[model samples]
Target: MKKAILVAIGFILYGAAMWYYLMHGAQADLPVQFRGSAADPTMFMNDRQLKLSYDFSRIKDWIYFLSVPLEWLIYLLVLGFGISKKMRSTVKEVTRFSVIHTALYVLLLSFLSWILTFPLRYYSYTISRDYHISVQPFKGWMKDSLIDFWVGWIFTVLTVLVIYFFIRKSKKKWWLYAWLISIPFTIFMYFIQPVVIDPLYNKFYPLKDQVLKEKILTLAERADIPASNVYEVNMSEKTNSLNAYVNGIGSNLRIVLWDTTLDKLNDKQVLFVMAHEMGHYVMKHLYQNLIGAIILSFFGLFLGSRIYSWAISKWGKRWGIKGLSDIAGLPVLLLIFSLLSFVAGPVENAVSRKAEKDADRYAIEMTKNPDSAVGAFQQLTISGLSEVNPPKLVKFFLYGHPTMLERITFLDSYKHKYEPKELEKAKKQQR
Candidate 1:
């Protein structure tokens, strides 16, 4: 009877999630506004700017598209074939202790999942290399991949143990307790990732060019960002793409630039990029996202609890899951989370796009260099093979940052100080 009540609550929460998003998160569908003449020659990219010969092949696009569904399919297979239960039993036989069995299952499940998913991963890398986006040698990439696998394994063990503990202790309210715990865990992971986890793959050092570093430090200071030193990572060894980011919290905080970005972008472009990254910190986007995640996790976990109960009720006997506490149900939990994430993409992207837009505006205002912002985005477009105008579906579902065209157009429309009369005139012109 209690299970039935939970299931009904899940359905209610799911409906509420949908309605909440419709009321609050559906603003992303609003039409884009263009100022100035549509026929303005500067609005379109020239041949060199567009990189006419760039090999952003349709095959690569299809591969990316297909891989999304393929990933969900793989997750489904983990549960559908009874592999999750069989592996759980095997680990149980090896160790009768719940804690040891959970640890063993985490390792076994990670290894099996990695093995099953490696082909798609290899193909994805092959495509990146084929398109000249990745410059890392296969052996080097594989070594990094191995490191990444073990790192993921460690985290999985920690998470699965906590979750099962909650399930065993409070079967009905575990989701609530787990969600509460995850808030701090998420923040800790974010805070530590730049310092601890990221260094495992790429080497980082202080920016070598003292002049450039000072310039970046000056910009950071001007932005009131607490970062004193600038760091550069050996990203050229991995990819030809350009990027810079401000990461970590408190003493661990610093601005990191990719060596590739330094090699390719001029000083002004690099400054603008740094400023954009600093904008994120100044705007407190990290804290905002954390708060948002905590809120959403409440709804998501509640809904997931309902779905989980229903799934286990239908498949529990066949899959050998005794209840939520059963180790065999790990895959089911993972699948539920994955599905919820997939469904929540648009709402998440809407929030991300707003943050990115705010950062762009802050960077422009701080640097007082609209042209540099435009040039920086153009460079990103060419180097990253970013689609300037993606399909509507892709834009709505997948895009976290606005398209290069939209960003450049915004820069083009920048006005330092438009009088009320001029603003009215501009609005008329746009109409």
Candidate 2:
């Protein structure tokens, strides 16, 4: 009774802290760079351009909001009702090798999850199609989904094996060991994702437009990004929405622009967007995030191990798992991890929003073209049919980047401290 009361108090405090954080912000004050009037011409959007009637967006939002809890419930029901245990037993009966059994069990759960979530996935795709965001045919989408399923399955199997190995060896300290091992594994995955995993989904080729290519390369050079070549992905084959990003590290590091972006944005706007992506690289946001992830995972894993142990003690027999090392206990591990991830989401997003804001500032400072910066954001807002202002709770939990309106207003507020080079030259001649 006492323990339960303490737990409840902890939750109350957590909720209070989150509310205060949302109302105020992670920082003492929002930086001058992010505060500004939305009335500037550079941030303009006419009513005709705005999709104020929120039929599709509302539906999408509800679907998203419901999906998280629904998925959590599914995980709980599967584990709580002994379905995961039965499946694991069957896998073990079929395979003599424990590794094979674990692999099969993880694959089974992955496929089952894919099947269960198919309806929601299809609905989202349908809505995206209706909104003219997604252009891929159903068959193409299905193919991509299958590929994603296998990729996720392979990774899950490997992760589960490593986790169980630690569970067996370290017992009480398994989570700590797992977290230590995961840092390097996580970095390796980040290093390879752009080079290996991405190519499986889309074709990336060097920017074909020599002029645009040169402009991007020049911007990269200005940002002091080494030997940075601009690569364009065939994003139009899948979606109409525009995007560009910098991903990976070392040999895999590169700037990637969506073909849809090239199709929609003018050269100047594209340059500004590329500059923003370059800002992430130049600022080493990825490295910073990697370090943050490592730190967060330590706490997450530590907490998760305690929760998993408590859960096993309460329902070990009913769930058919002897202990944490039991292969049948995969669902329990997943449940604990999922819950932790959901809880930690707001913190992660806070960090991400700060990084994105800094990147936005960097882009504006480097380009000295507030108009192009604001225009790019305006275009993105229209293309994505984004809400100009989201509810505080929604934004706190979901938004990794500031809203488009916020970004546009920030750019509109930019003030130069000095005259332009051309103006300076003319003034010198007159003198």
Clash count (model 1, backbone only): 0
- For residues 151-174, write the lDDT of model 1, one tens digit per residue: 988888988888789888987898
Q: Please provide TM-scores, in order, for all candidate models, with all chains considered together.
A: 0.84, 0.87
Give the range where candidate 1 is weakest over 10 consecutive residues by summed lDDT: 34-43
Runs of candidate 2 exceeding 4 Å displacement: 1-49, 415-431
Model-by-model lDDT, in order? 0.77, 0.80
Residue-level lDDT tens digits of model 2 in 1-431: 46446654764565556545434443322344444455222235556444431344555665666567556656766776688889988998896998999999988888888888898899999988888878999999999999999999998988898889888898899898889899999999899999899999999999999899998898888888885578999989999788999999888897899998998899989998998888999999989988988999999999999999998889888878877788878778788888899999998898899899999999988887776777788778767766666656667778999866578777777744222654687899999
TM value for model 2: 0.87
Tell me how far the alpha carbon of residue 101 in candidate 1 is from the true structure, in angstroms, after superposition: 1.1
